[model samples]
Structures are given as structure tokens and as C-alpha cells.
Target: MIPETLLIEYNATLKTFDKDEIIFSEGEFARNYYQVKHGIIKMNNFNDDAKEFIQGIFYKRQSFGEPPLFIDVKYPANATAIEKSTIYILPKEKFYKLLQNNKEVHFKITESLAKRLYYKAIIASEISSQEPSHRILRFFDYLKNDVFKQEGKFTLKINYTRQQISDILGLRVETVIRTIKQLEKQGEVKIENRKVYR
Candidate 1:
């Protein structure tokens, strides 16, 4: 269902992208915020070695592009669709003005930014304090607890591969594989092909 508020204060724009499509590149003008009505979007950055590191992945009912637009800065990471996607575009100025007039909108934006910062701090803490396998396990634990629940032995969603998961967790693919195998051995998780079990 579309938000009536969005319809009144914003404009819906349909955008289509194929799998692995770059929706917006790093350093692009963040003139609008996007709402994902369907499909998935992954935000990634290139490391010093030029390997794309997945920072975050979002699915249906989620939104992105807010921080850069609100801060009046270029995007810090690239946004790519993991599959075919459709997004609703909300122009920054209109959105900002609406927020300025609506205390509820203002509070909601502030709350979202605070939650994002908290997640970033958690990621930094995990990188500093945990070993590779532990970090990957912790990452999966987080996904299970927050993103999806266990269904039998596997997670409900299969959004990432070992390599992409490793990149996001700052671990090597080999380490990710080893960690998952260990989980499977412990009956904590199972893996078939590249699908995850929990």
C-alpha cells in the first residue's frame, strides 16, 4: 500500500533495473530519496584494493538515499539492484520542507539516522573485537534475529552469497565458508550450495 502522506507530499516514480544493475553510482547527486516498493538494493563501496565491499542490503518496504540528500552531499556508496527493482522517488527539497513543517516527520528522520549510526558503531565494534569466524557468525546471528527468522534449518531469506557476505563482514570468502561449515557441524546452521541455514 502506498502512503497517503507520500502521495500528497511526494511524487512516485517507477524505475526498472535488471539484476546487478547500478541504480546510482558513488558520488552522484543525491537529489531524491528512494522508497523500494519491490526487489532489493545493495549499497557497496570499493576498498583500497578496488574490490566492492557490501555495506548494506535492503529489500521491500525499505528506503535509502536520505542521508546524502538531507546533508546536501554526494552519495558515499553505490546503490545496485540485486534483482529487478521499482522505486518511488521523493524529491529532497519537497521532502525536507515537509519535514520542516511536520514535527512527526522530523522526528522520524532523526530516529532513523540515530539507528543507522548505532548499527555502524556495532559493525565497527565487531570488526575490532571479534575474530573472522566469530564475526561472520555474529553477522548471521544478527541477520537471523533482526532481518529474518529461522525456518527449519535455514533462514527465511537468501539475499547474499559467501563472497558478498564476507565482504560485508570484512572477512575472506574462505573464512566465511569455514565458519558456515562449522555452524553446520554444530547443527546451528546448514548450507546447501550457497544457501544459508539457521
Candidate 2:
């Protein structure tokens, strides 16, 4: 992600959003680059039956909705503030200028986008073919290993709620709950005081 000072130097503005506020809607023209300053943002889409599918969840210092800025396209999903959040917003033109002037920052952006693409591909495959338990395990492993960068068998507490995990994995909340309990019984995860750990 771009540094705060650099974002400010490029005329980026910090704005606050209330929980569940829609930052941008699907099909809107991409006009700005958003970096989370505090709290969380989720990019999602709803199907015909009104089922929500989470495309991605971004945390502090993480940037979202940049691919459309790089390519001339409308946003594919709606970005919403999942919690009361503050975000740094940089106009697309200034964002392009900043990247052009800063090669290192540009490379970092490319690397981040590539990793997201890899995650999308893996998750898509899991949803299509894997069992619920397998999908959940793979998703948790990705969070612990890739996102959090934790190694070995260290206990990593899950940051997402069961409902969030269900939305992300295309499963029902009951399925996620049952799977987690099953995983616990199978000695795959530890549930301590209602918090899940791996």
C-alpha cells in the first residue's frame, strides 16, 4: 500500500464511513483508489436470490478497488464499509501520477493485485469442487499463511465471524457452524471460549 504521507502529498483525502455504508456501487465508473486507514471494507455482490457473495475483505493499510482504475472498466462489485471506518481516497488521475512517479510503489501495487488474483482463482476452485469442510480449511489456511504471514503451528485466532466466513465461502451459516464444530471434534481446530483458533 502507498504510504500515508505520499497519499496526502498526492491530494488524497481521508473520509469516514458508517457501518454498512455503500462506498461505491457495482457498475460505477472507478474514479478513486481507496486504502483503508482504519476498520474493514468488503467488496461484494448479490445474486438474483439476494444471496451475498463476498469478493474480498480488506483491512487496515490494504487497498481495494484498484484493478478497475488500472483498466478502463466499471466496478464489478459493490464496496461497503463493514464497520465504522476511515479510508484514504486518492483520485484516479492523481493515483496514476503517483504510481508513475514512484516505481517502487507501482511494483508493490502490481504484486498485491497478483496475490489477490491467485486467491480468487483458488477460492473459485474450492467453491466449485471442494466439500464444505475442505473449503473452510483451505480458506482458513490461506488467511493464516498468506494474509497474516504466520508460519509453523502457531495458534492463529480467526478474525472473521461465522456469517462472514459463510458468505465468503458460498455456504450457509448453519453449514459453517456445523463444519467448524466437526473440525473441532476432528482435532483440526480449537474452539476456546467461543473463539476459533488454528
Top-lDDT structure, candidate number? 2
List ranges where model 2 is wrong by over 4 Å: 152-154
For model 2, the local distance difference test gives 0.94
Q: Where in model 1 is the C-alpha error above 4 Å?
A: 1-9, 148-155, 192-194
Per-model TM-score on C-alpha atoms: 0.85, 0.96
Residue 38 displacement in candidate 1 (angstroms):
0.9
Q: Residues 1-198, candidate 1, lDDT per residue (tens digit)?
A: 235466355655667788999888999989877777889899999978898788788878677767888668899999999889987776777777666777776786677667667767877898889987677767776677655546454655556888988888887888888877887788777677668766
Global lDDT of model 1: 0.76
Worst 10 residues of 1 by lDDT: 1-10
Worst 10 residues of 2 by lDDT: 146-155
Residue-wise lDDT of candidate 2 within 19-85, one digit each (tens)?
9999999999999999999999999999999999999999999999999998889999999999999
Query: How many clashing residue pairs are found in candidate 2?
Result: 0
